[model samples]
Each structure stands twice: as C-alpha cells, then as structure tokens.
Target: MNVSLLLILLLVGAIVTYLAGDKLASKVALFFGLASLGCTIVLLNHYNLGENISFITRWITQPNVSFALKADGLSLAMVLLTTALTPIIIFSSFGNEYKNSKAFYALILFMSFAMTGTFLASDGLLYYIFWELALIPIYFIALIWGNGDAEDRKKAVVKFFIYTLAGSLFMLVAFVYLYLKAGSFLIEDLYKLNLSSSEQLWIFLAFFLAYAIKIPLIPFHTWQANVYQKAPTVGTMLLSGIMLKMGLYSVIRWQLPLAPLAAKEYLPVLIGIGIAGVIYGSIVALRQKDLKKLLAYSSLAHVGLISAGTYTLTLDGLRGSVLQMIAHGFVVVGLFFVAEIIFRRYETRTIAEMGGIRAQTPKFTSLFLLLVLASVALPTTFNFVGEFTVLYSLSQINVWFAVLGGTTIILGAYYMLKMFQYTMLGETNKRIFADVTANEGITLVLIVAVLFFFGLYPKPIIDLITPSLEEILTQINRIN
Candidate 1:
C-alpha cells in the first residue's frame, strides 16, 4: 500500500477501534499505533535529505487550495515522534479502568490522527483546521476523565478551551489576511509574498498570539497550570508531550519566515519575556504542593527558554529549540508517567504526602531518580544537549539573555531535587504503598532509554533537522 494510504488507514482504524468495545478497543488502538510507527519507519527509509514528499489532490479551485500534505525533515521528525509516543501513551493508560474504555481509546487514536495532520499540512487553512481539530479530543479527555475538584476541573477545561480558541482566532485572521494579500493559502506562497513592514507587524502579532497561547508563554499561561493539574495522566502526557509542540513548531514554521524583519526587530522583547517566564515558572513550581502542578510549571519554564531560543533565529538556536522540543516531550511525558505511578501507589499527588518510597520500591525509585536527572538536564541526557545548544545560540545574540535563561538549569535542579529528596530519600512513611507495576516500569524504562540514547548521540536528530533549518534560515536571510 502507498504510504499516504496507510496514513488514511490509521485514521480509519481509530474509528473502528471506537466501535470495537472495551475488550478490543485497547488492542485495536495498539495495533493502529504500531502500524503508524511502522509507516514512520518506512518513511524514514524512503526519506531523502534534500527533498520533500508531497501528496495533494485539489480540494477547492476558487481559493487555490488543495488537500495538500507534505513531509520535509522537520515534519517527518515530528511524525515519528508522534507515532512513537502514541502507543506508549495508550499502553500507559491501561492501568486506569475507565467507564467508557472504547471511547477513551478512540479519543487517543483520533488525537494521534489530528496531530499527524498538523505536522504534515502544507496549506495554511488545512494546518489551522487540523490545529483546531486536535484540541477537541483533548478537551473532552480532560473534561470527562480529569481529577481534582469536579467544579474546578470543569472550570479549568473551559478556561483552557476559551484561551486556546481565542488565540487561534487571531491566527485565523492572520491567515485570511495573508490569503487576501498573497492570493493563496499555501505556506510556500505566503513565504514568497513580500509585505510592507506595517503589514508584517500586524500579521506577526496575530500569529504570535496564536502560538504564544499554545506555548502558553507567561501571563497568557494562566490557564495551563490548572488544566494540567486537573487533567488525567494520559491527558497531561498528550498535552505536555506533543500538543505544546504545535505552538513552538508554528513559531518556527509560520512566524519566523513569514515576518522575518518583524521577528528580528522584536527578538529582544520576545527573549525578555522568555527569560521572565523561566524565572517566574521556576519560582512558581518551587511552591507547588501537587507533583503534577509542579511539573506543569516546570514545563512552562522549559518551553519559555525554547521560545527564546527560537526568537534568536540563529542556526544553533533553531536547531536547539527543535531538539529541546523533542527532548522535553519525552522527558515531561516520562516525568508525568512517574507521577502517575506514585499516584497509583499512594492515591495522592501531594509531594509532602509522599515519603520514604525508595525503601519499598527500589526499582521505581531508581527510574524516578533517572527521570528527575533527565528533567534537570544532567550530562549525557538529551535535555543537556538541547539546553547547551540553546544557551550557546542565545549567547551569540546577548550574553545577559543567556545568563538569565541559564537560571532554568539552577532552578530546574532545585525543584527536581527537592521533589526527589522529599519523595524518595530519608525515612519510610509508614503508610502502605505498592511497588511499581510491571507495565509502569516498562513504560518509564523505555522512555528513559530513549532519553539517554538520544542524549549521548544527538547527531542523528541534529543531522535530520539541519538541512530544513538551513532552508528556513536561507529564506529569512534573503529578506535582509
């Protein structure tokens, strides 16, 4: 079968999984996820470094739009990440018995389809459609399955939905404006259209609001902590691990190249906000009692640095941001999964409530320790490689920015260590707790292996993204 056909089949399988009932839903979802991974490997095998794979059939003639999908190195990388993680996420949720398991699995599979579409979409309208489509399942997943005060969860979901949709409306306006001026909604065409500085500024702001809300950069991020804390483990995993990347990815794909001059001129202000988010997020995390909430704030800090690195518009900065996105996805998902394990054992997410767990669950403690270290970006972890490159790139733009941004490492270490010391070290809490289950252990171990494997040898990911980053940089450089 053609590769594109396989992609369509994966979506079809998701629907079928939904109808298959509880016993078979997980099995079907797992099969589709593995098949998607298989397709990704096939794509990797056929991938050409210098060329993109395009599959398009005209959808509308008047607007000059087509049902277009294409994969470059960057898109392919994201696709692989999506495929690789979806199965793990699906499997990770097996421990929780949901009232509607079939619907739950269906939503997960559907989310995978939407995310894959987001990465492959070449048309601006199509990208936005998929972008919005991706949020629906997650919203439902969090709304129906989330923990915390029932009323609070509902409020968090609504706030998240409203905040994201509001930001995206601005992006839609930006897209429509580009379509009006450029006479097409194709991303490549938008890239080629030359706009006056005034037009660029307005367009840039519109796009910035959309992506910033998704990245949830400070002030705009008011909704994220509540949402993450209320969300189910699987919901949090999808949100942090992949959904957040959509915003960061757009910053590179749309904002930077579309308005190069605006990006260059506003880079400093952007970097300053990124620095503030880093400090603010870390400080906030330091005070968070709920482990999930702490990780949520920590995620904000990490992505802030990524946003700053992206604005630098240097080759290393771009490369680092992309790499960091991948690394953070894996690390954060793993961290949340570990949190889920603790919650399962102790029936609580409070850090103070968890004590002396290391004695009872040595294996769980060991894996948790490694994940915490990865979160803090210890050497030979993927986070270290990404942070080092991002900071190096930032230094070229401004030493102070680098200095401010580098505090993430210090702050990261402080929070992660504090959590670790409280949870795993010292006296054993006399309360009864189960050791890590086989399934939980396998999931975490797999994630940690990937983190270390990529950390020690980031050359492969860097090599994959470099050509595409260079292509994007070339376009930006042409403006000046």
Candidate 2:
C-alpha cells in the first residue's frame, strides 16, 4: 500500500478503536500499531536503495499553503523511531488499568500520527501545524493520566503548553516573514531565498526562540522537570524520547542553512549556553531525590551537548548531534521505564526511601545497572559512541571546550552511581519488593540489545545520515 494511505489508515484505525470501547480498544490499537510498523518497514526497504516519496495537495491559495509531505533519509529514520516505539509504549500501557481505556489508546495512536506528520511535512506552514498539533494529545495525556498532586500536574501541563505555544508564535511570525519575502512556503523555496544579514538575524532569533523553548535550554527549561515529574511514565517517554528531537532536527533543517551568517556570528554564545546547561543540569541532577526529575535534568545535560555540537558546524559535530539524538532517545526512554518499574514496586519516587533492591530483584538490578552504564557512557553502549563523537567534534573547535564538556561523563557517572548505590545496592531494608515482571523485562532487554547493536555497528546509521548532513553543510557553507 502507498505510505500516505497507510498513514491515513492508521488514523482511521485509531478513531475506530477509540469508538470500540474498553473490551477491544487496546487490541485494536495494537493492531494499528503493528500495521503502521509493517508499513514503515516497507517504506524503509524501498528507500534503502535511494528513493524519495512526496504527497502534496493544495490547502490554501491566498498565502500559498499546501498539505505537503516528503520523506528522505532523515524523515524515514524518525518515522521508524516513532512507529517502532509506539507499539512498545502501547504494550507498556498494558500494566495500567486506566479508567478510560479507549481514550487512552486513542491518544497514543493520535500522537503517532502527529509525530509522523511533523517529520514528513515539507511546507513550512504544514510543518508548523503538525508541530503544534503534536503537543495537544500529550497535554491531555499528561493532564488525565499523570501521577502526583492533581493540581501540580495541571499547573505543570499549563506551563508547558503556554511556553511552547508562545515560542511557536514567534516561529509562525518568522515563517510568515519568510513567506512574504520568498513568495512560497515550500522548504526548498525558503532555502533558495537570499535574505539580507539583518533580516536573517531577526528571522533566526524568532526561529531560535521557538526551537529553544521546545529543546528547553537553560533558563527556558523550568517547565520540563516539573512536567516530567508529574506526567505519566508513557507521557514522559513520548516527550523525552521523540518529541525533544523535533527541536534539534529543526535547528539543522531550518536555522543553520537558512541563516548561515547569523548562526556563525551567534555560535559562541549558543555554545556557551550549551556548556552552561550541561554543567548546571548535571549539578542540579546531583541533588534530585526523585528519579524522574533526575532523568529530566540528565536529559537537559545531554541535549546541551547536542546543541553545542550543532553550533560547531563541523561534519563530526553535526553527525555526532544526530547520532546522540538517537542514542539519547533510546537511553532516556529506557531510564524512565526503569523509574516506572521502581515506582510501581516501592510506591514512591524518592531514592532515599528504597534500599538493597538488587538483593530482592536481581533481574531489575541487572537492567538498572546496564541503563546506568549507558547513561554514564560506558564503552560499547550507544551513549559512549555518541559522547565520544561529540567530544571529538568539540575538541576540534577548542580543546578547552571539549575538556569542560567532557566533565559531564564524570558527573554523570557520579550521580547515576550514587543513585544506584542508594537504591539498588547496600543493606536490604527488609521491605518486600516485587521483581520485574516478564513484560518489563522484555521491554528493557530489547532496548539493551538495540543499544549494544548500535554501539557495535554505528557505521550504517552514519552512512545513512552522511549524505543529508553533507548536503546541509554545503548549503550553510554556500551562504556563509
């Protein structure tokens, strides 16, 4: 079947499942998830030999908008990630006996559709529409299914919603300005326009605010930890695992090449913020007692490295950023899932409340240990590969920057191990805790296998992304 047809079918299936009610809702959603995965695999197979797929239909003519979707190596990779993980996330939700099962399953599938659209959108307006569209399901997901004080979750969700919407309005204005100047909303048209340096700077700042808020770098990151802490584990997984990459991806696709000189001029300041976020996030994470909050801060630190790498504008830096994004997505999701398991058993997220978990749950201990090692960038884990590449790229920019940035590894190990020792090792408290179930074990072991596989063989991913990265760099160089 055609890819677009498959996408439409997935949405339709979701709607149908949502109406099907509790008894069959989850099963129907699972079927759609598996079907989407199958379609994604077929799309990947076809694209492996170098093919491009695009579908466009006119939506508006006054400002010249179209519902345009295009898939290249990058888009396909993101689609695969979205589709592959959606099933696992759906499966993960099996453990929760939600009140409105149909609505819960429906939201998961709808989120899949929005994410797919975000990656495949080729028109600037269409991209923005999908970008904002992706946030709605998540907002409801967090508000309805989240843990913690109901009022706290409500407040956090509102803050997250407002911050993202406010930033995106800036992006909308920037896109409209580009549309006025370039006379087209198509990405390629915007890419071809030659804006004056002054204009580019303003436009770049507008785009930067939009993406930055989503990435939630530094001062803009206040909403993230609280949201992650309050949101359901599945919601947190979707936000951190796939949603955050949207911002980083846009930086590469829209910011750098579109406003090359501004990017170059602003590179140092951006890198400074990135480095600061890395240290600040790590330090703050050191003090977090809640596992989810700690993971959120660690995520900030990791993405800070990614942001810094992107500003370097070197091949190694860009490549590493992309690789790091994929690595971080997997590792963070796994870490949060482990957190969920612990919370389920202990009925608390505070690390101090738990002790000697490994003694009671050897399997959980083994998985948690692997996740910590990956978090700390141990050799032969995907995180190691990404961190090594990023630091290598940073060293080329400045040895000192690399040295400072490299401290994250030590700091990361310190906090992660400290948390582990406090929770997983040491003397048993004589409090009985359930071991990891077969389902949780399956999810974690699968992630670990993928982590190891990618670490050992990153060449394929590098090869797939190289052509696109080189094309992007060439564009930036031309404008520079």
Candidate 3:
C-alpha cells in the first residue's frame, strides 16, 4: 500500500514505454496507465482494510525535507484523477501517429508521475520539486509536438513555460519563508508556525502569485488561451484536464491551510477576482470562432467558478471545488478531444466551416452532445452536481456573488449549444465524414461513462474527500 509505488510505477512506465520503441510506445503507455490506475484501486482497498498507505524517508537533510508520499482521502482523489485521466489521454492518442511516438507517450507518463507526486508530496520542498517537475514535460510536449507556425508555437510554449516558471519561483520563496519561520517543510510542521498578520500577508501574496498564474485567474490568466490554441490536442488535454487542477488543489491544500488568517481576511477580494474570471472568460468564449479556443475560454469560465468556490471557505465550497476539479478534468478533456476529432476530419478549427456532422456521424455526435450538455452543467450530468454545489456555496457567502457566478450556466449553455449546433448539427458538410473509430469510440465511451456514473452517484467521491476537507477546515478555523 506504499503510496510511493504509484510514483515508481509511473516513472518506470515512462522509461519502459520509451524503451519499447515507437511502434509499441502507445500500447505500452496505455498498459502502464491502466496498471497505475489498478494500483490506486488496490491502494484504496488496502486503505479500507486499515493498512498504512503513506510512507516517508528523509531525502534532503539540509532542507529538512523527506521523500514523502502521503495519501489521504483528498490526495487519493487527486492521484485517482491523474491515473484515471492518463489512460484516456493515451487512448486518445492511439488514433493519431505522433512522430517520436516513444517520447510522446513517455512524456505523458512522466507528467502522470509528476502530477501524482505533486498530489502526494507532504514535504514543502518535495512538493515544490514535484510542482516544478510537472512543467518540463508539458513544455516539451507543447514545444516539439505543437501545431501552427514553428516560430509561433515556440513563442507560445516559451510564454507558457516562462509564465508558469515565474509563478513557481514565488511559491518557492513562500516555502523558503515558511521553512525559516518553522524550520521544516513538512506540511504538519509548517502548519504549526505562528506567523504574524504581516508575515502571513506577504506569504499569502507570494503563494497566490504562484497558484493564481497556474490557475490563471483573471488578470493573471493571460498565458492560457494562446498556449491552449497553439499546443497539440494531447498537450491541450494535459493543460486543461489535469494540469490546471494542480493550482486549484494547491489553493486548498497549501494556501488556505498554511495562511488561514490571510485566506479569511481576503476571502471577499479573492472571490471577487474569481467571479471576474467567470464573467470575463464566459463573455470571451461567446465570441470564439475557433473550437479549441472556445473550449479554452470555456475552461477559463468553469475554473473561475471552481476558484470562486474554494474562496468561499465553507465545507460545501471545498467539496464542490474537488468535485468540480474532477468534473472539469473529465469534461474538458472530452471537449478538446472532440475538437481534435473535428479538426482531423475537416483540417480546420473554424466553427463556421463545420456543420451538420451528425447526419454523417451520429455516434460521434451523440458523444459530443453528451459532453457539451455536461459542460453546460445539465442535470443528470456530473458537472451539474459540481456547479450546483459551488453556486450554493457562493450563495451562502452572498446572494449577489452567486448571481454573478451563476451566469456561467446561461453563458455556458449559450456558447456550448452554439458550438454544438454549428459543429454537430445543421446542414451536412459536403466533405466525407466517418463515424468514430473503435479506439476513439472506446475513449469517448469511457469518458461519457464517468460523467454519467458520477452524475448519478457522486457520493463515493464526496465521501472520500470530505474528511480531508474537514481536517483542512479545522486548521483554518483554529487560525481564524
């Protein structure tokens, strides 16, 4: 039940997949992804049997850090997310022929490793290490394998890299400050430090700068749209699906717990900024002619709501944030993949160029429509559960805030329906169209299954994360 085994599996999977050669890399990667996910399920079963799944060993004595991996309910949720999404992501790739296929598959596994490590690392320095480790793979995945002009792709990847790197530096500084104050980077140790109001404020701001840019909220979100549009669909999936959750997860795991006073003090301001992103992103999405770009802005709006939910600092908010993180991860990946499906057929991203695809490909249309409905938070979809809970949390804070944040429902519906109608409905395009292939259909089916299953029975995931959120809220309550 050792949690670090999960990391080992993924890291080893990366190397093994690389060595497996180009022709077999995709299959090897998919196998490892499934194996890694199996590990999580087994770990959960052991957890239920009351076996210890957490273990730590001192790794860097100078920094007082440990090669630690701790999986609580919350950490497991995130790890499960990484593991669950990896196979789908890889499976999505099976339909394409990526050059240097070994490297491409290997990077995907490496990313899974880093993100899983990020979720499980309890030592601040160790967590920071994993945090920065994630950027490298995605950076390459985008840079080498990206689309559009070479120079333009280079610019976008560099901007994405530099912007996120700059954010990580601030987070490192904050961790350093905390290490000085507490003399250790252990999550438990840092939590015990009694910093003054001023100290908390600066540390809060520094960490905020890091997570804000990663989450890319409001004014700080400038790097997101371009990177998303420029990168290949796999790159875009990693970016939108799971990478963004690192920031939102950090806000709950690190920012709120470590600096409760600051979180409490600035709740209003933070929620305001998050809501602003919701409005701004949704409005921008309304006008996007590019399908990928539309999904990009739509991701911005959905995450803005999730961010706002976290700042509410209520149990409902935290729970909803977690729920929505999973929901968004699943839905956004599906949406982006749908975009890829469209582009592969038409070789164009322009929405106006696509119409009435359903007549030719009813199966693809059904899957795409299900995801679009989920994106708009339709009832009986998993996203509906997350969005409703988030809006409920906001209403608890203030009716007006909920009112503002709730616009995503109307706006999300508008834009998603617009995109759906233009792409999946209306007059059939004159070009030849084929139904989803077996591999692509399997991937989409897996995704749609998750949405419907969770949409019906979200209790399992909710229960899994609740105790952890409760523990976090206990910490914030003690400080406030």
Highest-scoring model, TM-score: 3
- The true-versus-predicted C-alpha distance at residue 210 of model 3, in Å, is 0.7
Best by lDDT: 3
Angstrom error at residue 310, model 3:
0.4
Which lDDT tens digits does candidate 2 get at residues 219-331? 88999999999999999999998898889888988889889889988888888888888999999999998989999999999999888888898889988988888888888
Candidate lDDT (C-alpha), each:
0.89, 0.87, 0.92
Our tally of clashes for model 3 stands at 0
User: Can you write out model 1's per-residue Cα lDDT over 1-480, one digit (the tens) per residue?
Assistant: 234655685688789998999889998998888888888877766775344466777788887786778777888888888888999999898888887888888899889888888888889999999899999999999999999788999999999999999999999999999999888888888999888888889999999998889998987999999899999999999999999999998888888899998998888999989889999999999999999999999999999999999999999999999999999999999999989988887898999998898888898889999999998999999999999999999999989999999999999999999999998888898886688778888899999999999999999888888988999999888787
Clashes of 1: 0
Count of clashes in candidate 2 = 0
TM-score of each: 0.98, 0.97, 0.99
Query: Model 3 off-target regions past 4 Å?
Result: none
Regarding lDDT, does 1 or 3 come out ahead? 3
Ranking by lDDT: 3, 1, 2
